[model samples]
Target chain A: DARVTQTPRHKVTEMGQEVTMRCQPILGHNTVFWYRQTMMQGLELLAYFRNRAPLDDSGMPKDRFSAEMPDATLATLKIQPSEPRDSAVYFCASGPMSSGNTIYFGEGSWLTVV
Target chain B: GESVGLHLPTLSVQEGDNSIINCAYSNSASDYFIWYKQESGKGPQFIIDIRSNMDKRQGQRVTVLLNKTVKHLSLQIAATQPGDSAVYFCAEKDWSGGTSYGKLTFGQGTILTVHP
Candidate 1:
């Protein structure tokens, strides 16, 4: 019954504002991923971390978006000076270190930038 | 510019009937494939997965078939229920430049509707 938990399930902000989304991964899970879902783009992976270290962030917007796993339990995605085009559902998923691991997802944080 | 895709955007079926959703991947080097079900407004849930080495895999009432020769993947659900109505996405894992575990590339997805 373990699940990944995300905070601020819904967020509304004006353009140029800063938005922060938090996630609490399943206890003992080591891999965390952040993804954005939009009607046009579908689901796109933004970043991923393993063992509290950042593994990849190439998919993320280099200028405004950043993802970090501050500790084993908490991971966060932040957008500074967020734009209207950035509005979408942000999902956090966590999985094991083994191959063919099943990534479990959180309910997701819905963000709307006006 | 490369992408994975579903054969159909939508499919409708009866309650007792079986449903098949198909996906085609452009990457021949992909070694692993996974099927995920996403309910409206929810994240994708793991349904089943198959490796390139295997042609077919089954679990519960669901079966996944992989045709590597054609680069096609399908999900078959027996006795489709209302709860089984959701968007199904096929994802492929390809080896990254230096990463140990491959990164997942998802298909556009197919929505399934089961009617009683």
Candidate 2:
């Protein structure tokens, strides 16, 4: 079955380390989304891309977090000087913008920053 | 600003019993709504969704009810099983502009505990 794929399903890093998470959306999907899930906040949309172009990233902290879609197949979220508060499950979802607009989610990358 | 929240933070139901979870939203112009079920350590999975034009939608044993006048939403799970125990979130679509199709604003989740 075709589904959104995420790399480094589990990441453990110390504070101040640079961490990058990758996502491969399902083929032919035109919309890609990045979301962060934590105990305090459920699923918050961090960034959104349509047709490999960034449309919105206001939810992301500009200083330390960056999200980009270099091409149609790949999307990445990077965190520099990752802090302990950054520990959470980050999810990548993909779907079409037409009718229904049902987005399918990835397994998520569980990050633990100590 | 749109704010979506749940009426109850946690609800416990016995196995095989029917469960209903309620949600409230501040936006009345919002059109699309979705419900997601998330287990511990996992991403949220789509449960069911309803457009503003419709009042109710059913999928399998799950049902979503929307009331636009009061800005309320509810999920009804029939024959609740242990596998159905998880946190449920109600999300509303915020159309900032043309690029807001897949952008969803999620609400505080309701925890469902099914006891056998």
Candidate 3:
């Protein structure tokens, strides 16, 4: 079965360190989304891309967080000078807009910043 | 200012019993609704979905009901099992003439625990 794949399933980093998470969306999917999950905030949309072009990143912190789809097969979310508050599970999801709005999620990257 | 929210934070049920999880959405323009189940240490998995034009949809042993008049949504699981224990979330998408870009807004999620 096709599914989104995420790298660094678990990571621990010290405050002020740079953290990068990678994702590979399902083959033939045209849309990718990045979301952050925290106990206090639930799930928050960070950004999304369509056809390798960013559609929106308004929910993300522009100062330190960046999301990019370098190519159709690879999507990345990076945090520079990450702080403890940045600790959360990051999920990558993808779907074909033409085939309805149903999206499938990866297992997620678990990040812990100390 | 629109948001999706759950009616209960947690629900407990016994194996073989039926369980219901309810969600409410503030946006009347939402046209699509989905239910997802997330187990511990895993991402959310799609369970079922319903559109604004439809009131009910059924999947393998699962059913979703949408009450647009009341802005309410519910997931009903038949024959609850211990494997069904997880956190469930209801998400809404309002294409709004493609302005929303098919983005989904998820609710706070309800934790379901099934006892054997």
Best by TM-score: 3
Top DockQ model: 2
lDDT of 1 by residue, A10-114 (tens): 999999999999999999889898989887788899988889888888889999998888889999999998999999999999888666677788999999999
Complex DockQ per candidate: 0.45, 0.48, 0.44
What does candidate 1 score on TM? 0.92
Winner by DockQ between candidate 3 and candidate 2: 2
Residue-level lDDT of model 3, residues A1-114, one tens digit each, is: 999999999999999999999999999998899999988789999998889888888999999999999889999999999999999999999988752468899999999999
Docking class of 3: acceptable
How many residue pairs clash per model? 0, 0, 0
Across residues A1-114, which tens digit of lDDT does each residue of candidate 2 receive? 999999989999999999999999999998899999876676789999988888889899999999999888999999998999999999999988765567888999999999
Candidate 3 clashes between residue pairs 3 or more apart in a chain or in different chains: none
Model 2, which residues run further than 4 Å from truth?
B1-8, B96-101
Residue B79 CA displacement from its true place in model 2, Å: 1.0
For chain B alone, what TM-score does every candidate structure achieve against the true structure? 0.89, 0.88, 0.90
Winner on TM-score between 1 and 3 is 3
